[model samples]
Target chain A: MTDVLELRDVHRTHGDGANAVQALRGVTLTVRPGELVAIMGPSGSGKSTLLNLAGGLDRPTGGEVLVEGASLGTLSHRRLSAVRRRTIGYVFQDFNLLPSLTAAENVALPLELDGKSIRAARRAALAALTEVDLADLAHRFPDEMSGGQQQRVAIARALVGERRLVLADEPTGALDSQTGEAVLRVLRERVDAGAAGLLVTHEARHAGWADRVIFLRDGVIIDSSGPLGSADDLLERTS
Target chain B: MSIRHGLLALLERGPMYGYQLRAAFEESVGGTWSLNIGQVYTTLSRLERDEFVLPLPENDGGQRPYEITGTGRAELARWFATPIERTDRPRDELAIKLALAMTTPGVDVAAVVQSQRTAGVRALQEYTRLKTRQDKQAQDDLSWLLVLDAMIFQCEAEIRWLDHCEATILRRTRTARPAEQAQTPEPHPVRKEARR
Candidate 1:
């Protein structure tokens, strides 16, 4: 399958040479359709930087980023934003929902930003909300719903349309374990249904949901590994 | 974690012959631990000797079922109430390997840490995958779910410890011992850029 997200030897440095900090250094990764790749590292390890570069929220100082075979490096600012709005879905720790809007409206925001018709956007938003199992609360405001519900709304917003590449940074940071797992389940389901996903989390348990894990250290990927060993191997070894 | 306690717990549910007990044990734990008939019989014999279970007369199929005794009930209750001691676990090989790597000559400690972490994360992911599947089941099955959670938490803790070991080792190597005061010349000091 063609990769929905690709970063070829990507590098991101802040400030001038003397005072520079390389947030990402020569890192390369790929997320194909139906794949969820996790980025795990301590703070300042370039996880967020890598996610931004992947989503075109930030440009790489060197190397290339391609989403769906289109190089992000060469896209115009307007075109890039359009791609970000149209194709990329972002879920952050904080729900990031507008307090004034209802759940449906919050989910519809991304589609609307991409110049989708309000009615069409609402339809897609409702479908996305239903996928997250929160369709009945479509008219509820952010404050009215719990954190998990709000986060699911944010996820619905992120994946409202054909947004194929979902970039989530600590998306489950604020919820309890059960709620957090539920949120991850939704993300995993989306990925399993053919969208590619990139999850940035410090929690190893959350990273377990991904097909592969990339460990970043000092702005570089030290190791990338496939889904952990089978559950049986663990029991046998430990026993 | 003990087969003895596991058998006692299963017998507390109801009477079962050696074969039935083995199948129930495997099915209850999701087949993570398989018990042979010999082991089951050995444990049952031990349980019978200890008066924790009473074996009945052989049935039509030559199956002799056992029931949990009052002492067995008390033992199972105690097992449930008492906390598991950390010292009860087997020696962690990763811990020993890392300690040896730090002290012994010519060991790339960071490499050891990374490789172990790779395996650790893989196992952690698998537990999470199983946990996810378990969550979707119509039945709650609390005991099995808790079992999965324990593995996930322990795996997370081990990985965190490995990360701590790597960081501590790196810091000490860089700060406490410079090349000037080094015991000997480095055998194969890995350059950071070379790894990229």
Candidate 2:
């Protein structure tokens, strides 16, 4: 199957010269269609950096990032923005919804920004919301919805249109346990329906939604394991 | 999780032979928990001995089925009515490990905490994965879903506890260090300088 998102020896360094901090040091990963890969690591382990790079919000200083077989580094600024708006979806810990927009409008924003007609965008947004079982709340604003509901709207927004790569950073960080699980259920459903996902989370329970998990430390990939692999093996090596 | 109660509950529905009982129990729990036929037979015998169940006449196939007794039905009702007490849980090895690590002379308590946290996280991941697959395959299996949810919640709680342990240990170490420094005599300036 084609990879929905691929990072080939990707490196991102902040600042320059003596002040340079290598946030991601030659990290490589691939998330294929219908796959959800979880990235887990300590703070400053480049989890967010990796997500940002995948989502085209940040550029890698070295190597390549490809979404849907198109190299992100080769794209022009305008083209990259278009790629992000149409092909990549992002769910942040904070939900990142515009307070002024209703749930459906927030979900439709990406499609609209990508030049889809407003009517078409709204229709797609409602469909996405319905996929997440939030169609009834499509008219509600962010503040009007519960944290779980807002996160679901965020997921619906990410999943709207033909966006095949979903990047989530601690998407459940702000919700209660039951609500967090509910959001994960929707994310898992979306991935199972053929969208590839890269979820960066510190919580293992949330990562359990993924088929595989990659552990990072000091900006390096330390270990990767499948759902059935014994986590004790990884712990022994790390400790 | 309780095989005794599980068997009784199955018997409540209808009489079933050993293999049937085992199959029903496994099915109800979504195959997440497997049961051995030998264990089932052993439990059935014990139940018969206790008058909680009675062995019925062998069918044409010669398979003897066990039927729940009136007392068994009452017991099942009591089990359902009573909440499981926390005291009934087994000793927590992780908690004990952390407590011992704090007092052990050569143990790296932080590493211990880290390892436990990693294991907890992994278990949580595995449970969640199971839940996702199970939900997709058997969306209406409430018994299995509940079992999976219980494990997920417990694993989450364990990770949280491990985090709490690490933070508390760090705080205690920080507070204790100054006192230890005050009690220890300062090295002679010449010796300290030579060591440096």
Candidate 3:
């Protein structure tokens, strides 16, 4: 199957000449259907820059980014926004829900904005909420729910229309450990169901859910691990 | 991860023989820790000598069961009540290796850090996968979950340390550029092979 997301020799530099800081340096990556890729790095390590480029929110100064096989650099602004809404889903650290909107409405907003009927949008939104096991809470407002519930609502919003590429930046950062794991479990279930996931997190515990991990430093991928065929080797040796 | 304590905790419910104890132990930990019958028997004998348990009459199957004594009950209760301290852990071999790599001549400290980080991340990923699979497939066992959590947390800590080590080395190298330039710099690719 074709990759859902791909970044080829991508570079993003901020500012001009002497003040220019390279946020991404010739980084290449790919996320396929059912694959969850994690980016791990310290602060100012270009994690967000890479994620932004992948999501088409920021353009790379060099090289190409193809989301669902469409080169983002070649698309028009209108087309890109369409792709962002229809192809890629982003879950932020903050739930990013409007305080006044109830959970189902928050999720439906994206589809409604994309020109679907409000009734159809709401039906799809409830289905998405059910995917996250929050169908019963769909009527609750973001303020009425816990942090984890709100994050799930954000996730429901992101992937409401069966978006194949999910980009998350510390989606679990604000919640407690158990709640965070619950949120990740939802993300993992989505990825397992064939949505490619790209997670940017400093926490290894959270990144552990990914099928692969890319370690970034000084704006470059310093290391990436293979199939982890040695997991049994590790546990056996330790025991 | 003391098997003796584990056995005592299990025996608290009822008397169990060696084979039964080993099976129960493996089951509780979700088979992460392998225990042969010898280890189980040895631990039982030790517990017997320590007066923490009493040997019961042989069953019809010729298996001699052991029951936890009152002292063993108290010990198990104490173990459960007492939080494990960091000092209880074994010496960290990864930390020692990184420290040694830093001081050793011609050693690529960055490579060392990266390799360790890769391994650390791999282990963490494995534990996470296992935890998810087990949680999905089996009835939830708190002990098994706790064991997986311990491994996951340890892996996370090691990766974090490796990250810190790499950052510190990079910062130090940038600040002490002149000195580092005078020392062994990374050899050119062509020259590196030629040197060997």
Candidate 4:
């Protein structure tokens, strides 16, 4: 099967000339259906840049990024936005829910924007919320929910339309431990059901949820290891 | 350390043979702590010697059963009521290693902290994997999940501590070097004067 997300020797740089900052250098990764890959590194090690490139939110300076066998670079702006809307789901550290929208409305926004009927979008949103155990709170606005609950809604939104690729950046950064674990459980369940996921986190315990871990250093892919592999040597050098 | 109390707690339910007690103890703790039959028997013997348990008549197969005494019940109650003191915990080897590394000359302290952090992360991953494999019966598997959570939390705390150690070390060395140089006379001149 084609990978849900693939990055081949991806390079991303900001600015130009001698002053240009290479945010990502020669990083190659793939996330197939049912695989969850974690990107981990120190601050400013290009974790976020890699995620942006994968999501098509930012263009790579070199190499290719493909989603489900289609090259993102070749897509027109309208087509790229459509692909992002229909194929990708993103969960940020902050919930990023619109305060004016109720949970279900927030969740259904993506589907509606993609031109699904409002009724169909709402139905899908309710189904997604039920998957995350938040159906009861569908009518509640973002301000009415706790941080964890809000994050659950965000996850519900991400998974609403059968999006195959989920990208999360420190999705549990703001929550307490128990709440964080609860959110992670929802994320894990979705990925296990065949969604490919790419999570960027500084917390190793959070990365523990991933099937494999990619370690970055100075914009380069330094090491890749299984969840149980000994990281002492790599950690020593990085630390 | 809690094995003695664990056995007594299991016995509180009813009289149990050594093997039964071992199985019950392991089950109650979610099978994370495995108690050998020999260890169970030894603990039972000690409890009997202390009058915390009484040995009943042997069954046809010669399996000996033991029942908790009133004293044992009271002791178990007290154990439940009391808070575990920090001093009672074993010395933290990681903390000791970091402390020593801080003072040792020519030692790469950051490297030591990093190695420990990596090991801690590995352990956290193992615990998480174990948790994932567990049955989804939250009510029935609560004990095991709690034990796993404890390990995960401890590993996370260790990693945070290691990061803190590295940062503090860097900050101190950056700020302390000039002060030390100004305070101490050149060692070479002092050695020469002493030799003369």
Candidate 5:
């Protein structure tokens, strides 16, 4: 069990004045290599706040976030940015895409920003698109593509940089059940390829597909269960 | 053993109808495995069609007896020797709704959670009443009263879980997923309407 990410006594507060809201409270978590974890919580339980801190997108009010032995709390902004670019991939519920860019261009953006050659980035981007079965839509812009297609493109972008860590916030939240299942299969394949990923979702079916699921409440984690082998396990765990 | 083979193995002891066969199954397996009577009957019909079992001549006593044929015994032996692969996965609906509620927009996930919680409370109250009645009659039928107790406990556990889910829903308002909401716009209205 090699941990790729770990959070200890993590806390996030929105304000310091009289109107402060504590999103996370002394929360602790860990994600191992090749593990697909689903963090489930009702709204306001600090799920996204925890994700933001873990991904280095936001600073936590307290606690330590260790990514590959390097504490995010100890890293400089530049160092964090570097870690984000190379070690992590993010997929949001909204297919965040540049409407002006094609699917291939969107995928290539990360590699290009990291100083890769345009030709090389484009080639890798195409390969990633193919993995999600959307190579033919590589030239399609976000507006031209269907919601599912756009999400698949987002997935390709996440998988493009050979990132070892993927963070998806409701990746299938925008698709129909059938399409959602298809999108989930891509994430499962990435895990099979040895990437450590954390999926934040409310859907038990999506959580059922993960290696493990953590239920959160009031900024704390509850039942932490095994590689959910089946849907029955999902219902059983919840019950 | 495949379920069918397990059934044949049970039937080999004696001719039995669906309910009797079910009881024999539970006793043989120490009640660890529960089979739906529907599944047993469906398999029995299949076995009869395959000539592994035959419908014995109808008795004037108005009971159907199923006797395993020689071929059925051989087939049952082979089945018992081969482990059956488990292929079906259970689907959890509550998890699906919560996930969608977080990502899907403009729709009140909390309201739906409350609705379910209310229904669960009603069901729990009904189960409590039934359990009380059964307890009072336990002296008349202890065995059935015990079965009712198990069912009541299951229903109570379900209600507790539903209450927990509702409490969680009430405690937080996850920031709406802008990207997910924008892309989805509305939860496939068709599915939502159909569900309603």
Candidate 6:
């Protein structure tokens, strides 16, 4: 299987000398196409840092972070941004929607930023929204929707560009259990559609959605256990 | 006793509200396990769904009280007699993190140990304060209080272990330490000569 994301000896550090905080220390990991991997750790354990590096939002201080054999560190800022726009999709914890814009408009923002025609962007956004079963609510603003509805819109936006990899950071943290489960169902559908997903979550229940769960701590993967026969298998093993 | 079975046995006496059941549980058990409100409600709902218990009609339109059904009594009896399967292995994330952090280069094991100790100390102090306040209440629920005591003791033990781990790491790193140097045993002459 072709790897969508690969990290080799990746190191990210904050500060210098005695005051240094090594967020990632010689971390090596990989995510393949159609694979859903959840990175779990306590606060400040560098789970978010790894996601940022993988998505090309931040460069590794040392070593390589490659997406489809393209080295992220070697890409120029403009090139990296373009690659992010065209190939990488991001779903964040806070939804990060425009209150004035409708659900369809928010999902269309990626295409709009990519300089696609307005009509084309709107049509594609509609189709994306329909996939999440939120097409009827496309005209509704973020403030008018529930937490689950807003998250679904964010997910549709992430899937709009046909991006191979989607990076989600605490995607379900803001919603109730039922709503969170619904949103996760949409992400799983996306994965089944051949898109790789890297989910950063603290909740083991949400991580249950992924194909594999990577246990990260202090900026490195400590252990990983996954590809279980079923969700109950995961719950049993972890519980 | 199983938590669900214990709850059913208490409710078998009579239908009672959430707080009343909690109070009864504390009195009977001498306050060992602290049942959070969330856990109680969730268990009640599951039991009701399973037909082991059912909610009785409320009096004066107040909170609903639960009553144990005949099925619940039978289930409770079976639970007391039979042991549930508990083959699952516990995965402690913090321990695993510390284990890996100790092996990884460039990261200071002592710093990791110190930070965990600091956090544990803070948690222990906060838990102690809460315990003091909980103890002074007119209706002090000793059941949950006892649970908190166990948690506090566990935290103290972890902090001590972390201190020892830090000391060991520091001592190992120190130059001219005989034990540290001795760990890398001198190669046997016969085995060493095989390379040449």
For candidate 1, lDDT tens digit of each residue in A90-141?
9989989999999999999888888889999999999999999999999999
- List, residue by residue over A1-239, the lDDT tens digit for candidate 4: 78999999999999999999999989888999998888877788999999999999999999999999999999999999998998999999999999999999999999999999999999999999999999999999999999999999999988889799999989999999889988888998999999999999988789778877777767998666565544333323322
Q: Model 6: per-residue lDDT, tens digit, B1-196?
A: 4568778988889898787887787666444445777778888889999999989888785878999988999988887787655444356667798999977988777567756654554454445444544656735675666666566667667766775675566656775587666668787788789988
**CA shift at A71, candidate 2, in angstroms?**
4.5
Model 4 pairs in collision: none
Best by lDDT: 3
Task: Kindly report which residue stretches of model 3 are placed more than 4 angstroms away from their true locations once superposed.
Answer: A230-234, B77-88, B177-196
**Which model is ahead, 1 or 5, in terms of TM-score?**
1
Clashes of each: 2, 0, 0, 0, 8, 1
Error of 4 at A201 (Å): 2.2
Consecutive 10-residue window with the lowest summed lDDT within model 2 chain A: A230-239
TM-score of 1: 0.92
RMSD of 4: 6.3
Ranking by TM-score: 1, 3, 4, 2, 5, 6
For candidate 3 chain A, the 10 contiguous residues with the lowest summed lDDT are A225-234
Evaluation by DockQ, superior candidate among 3 and 4: 3
Best of the two (2, 6) by DockQ: 2
- Tens digits of lDDT, candidate 1, B1-196: 7899999999988999999999898878776777889999999999999999999999999899999999999999999999999899988887888788889999888899888888878988888887777778736687777877888898889889987887787777788777656656555456555666
Candidate 6 lDDT, tens digit per residue, A113-146?
Answer: 9999989999999999999999999999999999
Q: What's each prediction's TM-score?
A: 0.92, 0.77, 0.91, 0.83, 0.59, 0.57
lDDT of 3 by residue, B1-196 (tens): 6889999998998999999999998888767888999999999999999999999999999999999999999989999999998889989888898889989999999898888788888888888988887787875587888989988997888888877888888888888998767578775788888989
TM-scores of chain A in all candidate models: 0.96, 0.94, 0.97, 0.94, 0.93, 0.94
> In model 2, what is the error at residue B110, expressed in angstroms?
8.9
Interface root mean square deviation per prediction: 2.1, 7.4, 1.8, 8.3, 13.6, 14.1
RMSD of each: 6.4, 5.8, 6.8, 6.3, 17.0, 15.6
Model 6: per-residue Cα lDDT at residue A210: 70
Instruction: List clashing residue pairs in candidate 3.
Output: none
Q: Give candidate 5 regions above 4 Å deviation.
A: A228-239, B1-165, B168-196
lDDT of 5 at B42: 94
> Over 4 Å off in model 4, which ranges?
A15-21, A229-239, B85-88, B95-116, B135-138, B169-196
lDDT of 2 by residue, A129-238 (tens): 99999999999999999999999999999999988889999999999988998988888888888999899998877876788888787799877666547533432332
